[model samples]
Target: VGRYLVQLPRGALSAHDDALRRAGIRVRRGGAVLGAGGKASLGPLSPARRKPPSSSPRLDAITLQEQLERALRERQARPTGICPVREALHGALLEELAGTIARDEPRRGTLLRRVAGEARMTIDAYRTVYEKSLLFGASKLSEAAALKGNLEGRIAELQAETASLADEVRSLTDLCESLEHRAQRAEAQAEAETHDASALRAEGEQLQGLLDALRPG
Candidate 1:
């Protein structure tokens, strides 16, 4: 017998024949059964003379075939969209296809491009923040420059005022020195007048004493 069983015809006799062939019994052209080694005739395995369990094949291919056929009929009778079997099989196949596509370089590159687009959006957001920060810094710097200019102007005014004060102080110092010299000369004149008064008083006293001596006899 061949490794693969030949397709059996659709009948009880055909099933019996296939089963016999599976069990290492071969039927010849004239309905005689021979052993697998061509030894001798076992008997004929016709459907009419076949007994129940004694002549039965180890596995009944007819019953299994009937079950498969019934299952196919039921599946065909079901609505296409609501059938669980079809959906499950389709889902499994889709999962396998997805896995295959995921491994392909072009599909992977498309996913990478999507991620890169998101990254670019994030970078743009940061750039906006950076630009606002730069504007704020520039504003602060401008204010500082304006304040410095104001301070410089105030300092110039103060320096000019200080120069005027210094000139006034110098004039006052010159006036004070002139007044001190005048006060010293006035003190010397007062001392010389006091000495002259004392000398006049002494001479008058000596003349008075001589007159009094001559008038007395």
Candidate 2:
């Protein structure tokens, strides 16, 4: 919806005007655009009044009344080459707008008061709504923290168990090395004893032979 100076036949224009207004469009007529005795239509503005480019957070923070005041002040502050008749028409247009706003102020105030009363009636319920949202968010955070703590505890237990298993493995490794050393020593001793026994048997046979020779040769 926008402010438009669209031209149509008297009948079509009236119907179109009603429709546009219902849809929140500001339809400007030629006479209504300048002043009460202005023409049936005015020339289209250089740039159409479409939605303005998206504003920043700082601009969005400006209230509607403030924006309106700033726009009025800017227009008044600027120097223009408007002809005398056009300037007069512009002044008349401003006067008419002021009168219209003055007339509507009471109705607007009544609507505002009614709305404020309704809001007051529901304020407690709205408070509960916000409280519930906070409670849910806090609960989720609490659960996440608990889960994180449990995971950390489990990791610590696993690390401790792994360290204990590693020590047991080291002890087993040392026992195996000792057993291997003992087996090797026993094998060497058995080989040496067998060699000594063979030498002793051979000496005893030679001594027997000598005794036979000395007894009855």
Candidate 3:
């Protein structure tokens, strides 16, 4: 009379209970079942099941495995000219592997290994394609690292060039300011000289008028 608590869907529980009864194992369907010593045999079951409501949502383990394999095969079947899609597939595979590795489930390592094997197979098949399109013989990760390094270097060079150009602009701006200041001073001096010349001409006109008056009288 060993009691085993099985948590499953209502339908699944009914099926299991029927099966256990057929095997001569005692099973009771209620809120909680206790063991032989009157200790609680089963923990509290959440009313909500972990799985989706749909009985057949096409997310079975076999279907998922098949889909993953099919995707890998399709990617392998592509022509070498289709490098972008191949690279995209490779990236997707890598990301899936990372996600699988991050999962806390006991089967996470197994899933990751399966995905890694599939990715490796696809990568082997697309090696030639990558060499042709990516123009490098290295693996995708290596190529990515190299591309990143090259971009960083180019960015640094561009930044340095931008700084130099900014300095040049600042120098030009300062020079323009100095020229403007000198121009303002020259304009003020010219205005003062014109005023002095006008005063001298007026005095000479007055002297000439006096000399003419004295001569005529």
Best by lDDT: 3
lDDT of 2 at 7: 64
Q: Score candidate 1 by lDDT.
A: 0.61
Against the true structure, candidate 2 has what lDDT? 0.60
Model 3, residue 162: displacement in angstroms?
0.8
Give one clash count per candidate, in the order shown.
Answer: 0, 2, 0
TM-score of each: 0.41, 0.39, 0.38
Model 1 segments beyond 4 Å from truth? 1-122, 203-217
Q: Report the candidate with higher lDDT, 1 versus 3.
A: 3
Residue 50 of model 3 has an lDDT of 22
Instruction: Please give the TM-score that candidate 3 achieves against the real structure.
Output: 0.38
TM-score ranking from best candidate downward: 1, 2, 3
Q: Which runs in model 2 stand beyond 4 Å of their true positions?
A: 1-138
lDDT of 3 by residue, 81-184 (tens): 55556566656656544554455453775777777779777876777676676655456778789999999999999999999999999999999999999999
**Quick one: best TM-score, which candidate?**
1
Residue pairs clashing, model 1: none
Q: Quote model 1's TM-score.
A: 0.41
lDDT score of model 3? 0.64
